[model samples]
Target: MQGKRVVVTGGTTGIGRAIVRSLASQGARVVTLGRDENALKDALDAMADLPGEVHGIAADLATREGVERLFAEADVRLGGVDALVSNAALGAEPIDEMADDDWRYVVEVNLVAAMAATRAALARLGKGGQIVIVGSISAEIHAPGESVYSATKAGLQGFAETLRKEVEERGLRVALVEPGTTGSDMQEASDDEQREEIAKARMLRAEDVAEAVDFILSRPPRVDVVTLRLEPRLQELP
Candidate 1:
């Protein structure tokens, strides 16, 4: 991964942070984006001692202007992008009970932003570049209270499938990594005990998902990893 130019979204915490750290630690030039300025500072501070180059950008992917700004900065900082990790997303409530704005926000962040980022990245990504979409196992299991989140993730899966074919002739690879019940702030545990329970054998750690992303990116140009699903040993579906 030495000197490889990479971009990561939602990279202040959770799985996104892990991916940033992993790539940067391996000597990749990494530019990560998040919505919070302070959080972005903290992320850059956390990587101060790393051997590779890592920069933090504050941008909200929900807006077209913000997305364009991110890509423009990437052009200036990284020269060209070799890999893009679309990891920014939020959990959502049931569709029927969710307000219209709430539904739109979730869709814009999870689905639309991913497509926008990929579209921009393609302009900078030459042959042998990679696009990794961080998805959720909820898309496959269809958990009852998370209809909106599941629907968006399912849409991402479809997007990745078609994108791989569209970009195949260009020597680009598009892959999806869907992790189940990861231990992160996004889990929204109610209390300390609940957090402990969720952190136990029932959940996959953020590093686990990061490792999946690293593996997909490390593959040679001739190989394309279509989809990877990661779940804890004891996790079960109903």
Candidate 2:
């Protein structure tokens, strides 16, 4: 990963933050984005001592304009893009219970933003460039009370699969990492409860997902890891 220029979205907290640290620790120049300025600053400060360059941008990904600005900044920061990690997502209440604007915003940030980011990245990425989408196992399990969130993740599954076929011949690799019951800010459980679940092996840590991403990107150019499903050892299916 040395000298690789990468972009990670929604990287101020949770899984995305872990991915940024993992990549930077391995000597990859990383530029990450999040909507919260303070969180972005904190994340950048925390990663200041990593082996590689780590930069943060505060940009909302819920709109095309924001995504465009993010890529524009990345162009200036990294000069070129070697990899793109679409990891930003928003949780939502059940479709029937959520306000129209709220649900639409979830769809925008979780699904539409990812597609937009991917499209923007494709324009800059060349051979051996990689695209990794951080998805969720909720898509497959269809857990109750997660209709909106599940729908977005399921959409990502389709996007990643079809995109891989379309880009493979160009030497670009696309992969999806679906994690189950991860302990992150998106989780409804409290931090203490999440810690307990993690200790009991009923929940996965954000770093676990980060490792999966690193593993995918570290592979030889000839190998394309299409899909990786990572779940807690004892996570129950709905």
In order, candidate lDDTs are 0.90, 0.94
Q: Give each model a TM-score.
A: 0.96, 0.98
Candidate 2 stretches with Cα past 4 Å from truth are none
Model 2 error, position 195 (Å): 0.9
Give the alpha carbon lDDT tens digit for every residue of 20-64 in model 2.
999999999998899999999999999999999998778889887
* Model 1 CA lDDT for position 72: 82
Q: Residue 206 of candidate 1: its Cα lDDT?
A: 83
Local lDDT at 126 for model 1: 90
Q: Please give, for residues 5-117, the per-residue lDDT of candidate 1 as tens digits.
A: 99898999888999999998999999888999988899899998898888877989989987898888878888889999999999888999999999999999999999999
Q: What's the lDDT for candidate 1?
A: 0.90
